[model samples]
Target: MKSTSRQLALSLAAVTLLSAAPGAQAPASSRTRTHVQTLASDKFEGRLTGSSGEKLAADYLIAELKRMGAKPLPGQADFRMPFAFTAGSKDGGTTLKTMTANGMERTHEPGTAMALSFSDSAEVSGPVVFAGYGLVVPESQNFGYDSYAGLDVKDKVVVVLRYFPEDADQKTRAILARYADLRYKAQAARQRGARGMIVITGPRSPNAGELVPMSFDTAIAGSGVVAVSVKGGAWLIEGNGRSLDEVQKELDSGNPHVAGFAVPGVTATINAKVIRQQQTGHNVVAYLPASGSVSGVSKPWVAVGAHYDHLGRGTTGGSLAGKDEVNQIHHGADDNASGTATVLAIADALARQPRKRHLLIAFWSGEELGLLGSAAFVSTPPVALDQLSAYLNFDMVGRVSDNKLTVQATGTSAMWPKLLEQANVAAGFDLVLQEDPYQPTDVGSFNTASVACLTFFTGAHQEYHKPSDTADKINYEDLDRVGTFAAAIAKRLLDGDQVPQFTKVEQKTETGGRAGLRLFTGTIPDYASDVKGLLLGGVIGGGPAEQAGLAKGDVIVEIAGQSITNIYDYTYALELLKIGQPAKVVYLRGGQKQETTLTPAARK
Candidate 1:
């Protein structure tokens, strides 16, 4: 089963013999180019996930699959698989009110006194305890600090500054960042028996004269305490004749020996509310019945997949271009239209073969949005996951210039490299093999389930994710060769008795596949989110984000004062975050403005 001259000859003979079969119509280079052109053309509108283009493309694939005698999986359905995720936060309204010890009462408007996204929709009122930075760091490196230190905030609303000590040394700032989550801050308050927590940008912070803005992606599912930020809280504190500016200046002097206190004759009340918006998404799958099977043993199905989604007119899908700045149609011809086309070709070719096991050829939607379609399919597989023998994925297979073809997930199975070597003997190409199964493609979804998988790519170029990625740029002959190589491998896996072994990857990777980029924020960015801000699909539990209360769906707009208009900007900003220092991260949680201090760490 390994690479050998005899194996090579046999493999060539088998492919030739298979193609010569009465019903077999080997995938042709002309057909591959036609598929790519048909899928990438403007008539398809770039095949943006959840868009009309995607629907039309799906319809076309379904027709083609039907023509090839494709059927729905074990379960009955058309060629479409569907799933939903947090598209964004709903625009909601909130309110706040205040009553002083002197019987003076004031109620601030919603925009002027913003409600935090994570705040419970409840009310609280009492004497306010001023908590410095509202921070709590464990006994770490002798650098621990607690804003609730020696303070009696129980049953009272606690007023805390938004960040840690202003002038703390780099190490201290970094250490303090671990707990810079707003929800975590509220959690701490609730833990301390406080009814509520209020945040404000003290003189030492980066906010200006405006109400703190809430993010569009809300975080309304944590602790019982309600939280809000008041723009003019200085008047309530100044009632004690202690100027807020003086207190802030003193704290910012690099000596954060700052302390919290009770503001005499000052007390406040809080009220807040929220509304959620919901949306739906879809994925497409088609199945080809087995042609042949082992007589005495159960046979596993082979899954061939590729994402058919792309950034639509620079709207809401992952894009390298600035939001609305580069609004031309992004014709992702090479990104995966190439991969999708190959899947189409393979379906027709596989239909004519003997069914050893089932073949599931899928063209995924919302892949640009974070492999969502693939992830969804994996979550609720049409067939038993254990019955899946192997997954072969093709992405960006259109640009195989110089015969250099990149194959990822070689580590997934010991048989892969040798088999690939054997397959390439007849179709010569420079193969670059990567052992790690982690990649930004649909294959990652199968790999997550411990399924042996492989993803083929030509390589990235300047045109990737750009409007310039048109059908004309695709190297059709190269793409056709890739499809041929992949189809052969798929056929060998399905027809032979040997099953590829699955290897679980254990290499530690930083948040959002940033190990090579070198920085860990513990945030899993939603690659499919087309929002102007960086949308987080997930935050690693117990990581810095969870420690700081950063939750899923939170869209980060700025990091360390740098505007993050896109993922590329976020990447550039990561380089500026000094290790052992806390930097402000401004974000939106369902129309509520919120910020947090995050400490950067070297990627492990």
Candidate 2:
């Protein structure tokens, strides 16, 4: 009776498959579609890191892995691995007060004055100096504009105008705008030995006399100096024998000759406290041991992974949602759910057949927040780093237009070309191979750790990082094909006699994608490091950093005489470096101080 019922069920399944519409997905593709839909649904709340939605996604992935006969990584009790990250920052009771030479004092209201999100949490009181539009263009550009030129602001507070010159020509305005960020201005003040910086929006500019909003800051620490923005501060220059309007008009001429003057007997006291909110995020790690392991044979491990976290509710940054879609769920279907589903499919396929080596499958969180999860994993791994042979990463593989797929980080291993050629015969994909391993994804973490890595991606679209990126837009057939191709690559890595060797590729500097900065230092910062100074993950081969004897695991304490306490300070210091000009660098290696001179290169 049981055999007869099974035969009847098989007949019904065959009938259902035959009655499906033309171009319907097969069983494998159907499973992929199911995974994508389940993960990208509104119930997951976009799978934001450290949120309850992320926990639900983790549970679902854990259950799926268990169903595939995959167990927790070696020496682990469960599949969950947790890491800590600074979720966000907020202001805590910031205040500003001013006193004149005549003993007249005024305390600014909260709405009139506010601290920037990156400002250091401290109290400072000093004499004030009027620095005109604190703009400093890099010397390489030859624009020759410096607001601090010939100004003595040591041990004093600086009052500068916000934004660039309003009356300058388009080309001039463009150059100034590159260095116009408030954090850059604060760094300039700190480099000049100023105790604090106060920014005031000029009356002639747009949004005149409005305090700068406390925007979201992701830095783990402060910007090294007290910085604040005020709606209006005409009284600061009242004792300087000049009205704020006249000074602003003179400085707006773009002549570059206007100089800043000292505001006599005017001292201001500023107290700013920026509190960073921290949270713990988890990465799902599971392993499939070799099919039949020999007791004495040494086996290397290979990894396949993808990031599962995405923007939540179009808030907490990294959201491209439209104004109408504000506060809506940013369904990261193509952004990551497709990649996660593809990894799951690969895990299922490889679990059925494996011969030589173990497989580590990981689902990373906090990827949108600077690859935090992967960075944490590499810093502290369950197995020895040298035992990891290769890593395959899938980022966005759901939208395969015209059968085209981009495979990045191919240069990380010399064996990739032949291996990829062999794997593509059955899948027949038009592969675009990129040599650079300095990608903006989790692959970068593994690459910096000297692991051979490859990242698979389909072309980006208008729906990326936005609320419109829904599961219904995914192409399941091509996604399944991608999974099959990746599984074939994983099989070679797992069953082959020889593993791929790691290769260090020299990264090329492009003119775009550096936030309009012109100088290139070829330094890669480890954003997950908790040290007081900026930590170097790895430097580009044959670049300025490598030539200067800087290597991985070095902490940069100062660059070109500017103190570097965090990534923000390091970025601001880049604005002061000139192409082909040598600058002093101080760093800590193995807890020992070292110094070198590095020449800056111009980005192509």
What C-alpha RMSD separates each model from the true structure?
A: 11.3, 5.9
lDDT of 2: 0.86
Most lDDT-accurate candidate: 2
Question: How well does each candidate superpose onto the true structure, as a TM-score?
Answer: 0.73, 0.89
Model 2 Cα lDDT, one tens digit per residue, 1-604 = 1243354345436534643654453477767876787678787889999999899889979977886789998899999999999876777777889999889998876667788877888999999998899987767677899999999999999999899889988988988988888888888888899999998998888877778888765566667889988878877776868788888898998778899999889899998867777799999999999877635444479999999999889688889888999998888999899999999999988877856788999999999888989988998989777888899999988999999999999999999999999999998999999988888889998998999999999988999999889888999999999999999999998888778899998888731125676678888777666577888888888889999999989999999988898887888777678889899999999999999999999876
Query: Model 1: per-residue lDDT, tens digit, 1-604?
Result: 1233354345446545654576665447756665666667676677776678888778867766776788877675667777765554432556666677768888777777777754666778888888767776544235546677788888888887776667778877776765676755775676677888888887657773345565534122323557888786776566667887777666654354567788876777887664434445567787887754545545468889888878777566466765554877787889878998899877777777786888888888877867888877876788888888899998899998889999998888888999999998987889999987768888877876778999998898988888778888899887888888888888888877888888765434643654455567777676645466687766654556666678777888888876664564566467557666788999999979898988866667
Q: Give me the overall lDDT of model 1.
A: 0.73
Report clash pairs, candidate 2: none
- lDDT scores of the candidates, listed in order: 0.73, 0.86
lDDT of 2 at 450: 93
The runs of at least 3 residues in candidate 2 whose Cα sits more than 4 Å from the true structure, single-residue gaps closed, are 1-26, 109-112, 240-242, 291-299, 322-324, 510-513, 528-530
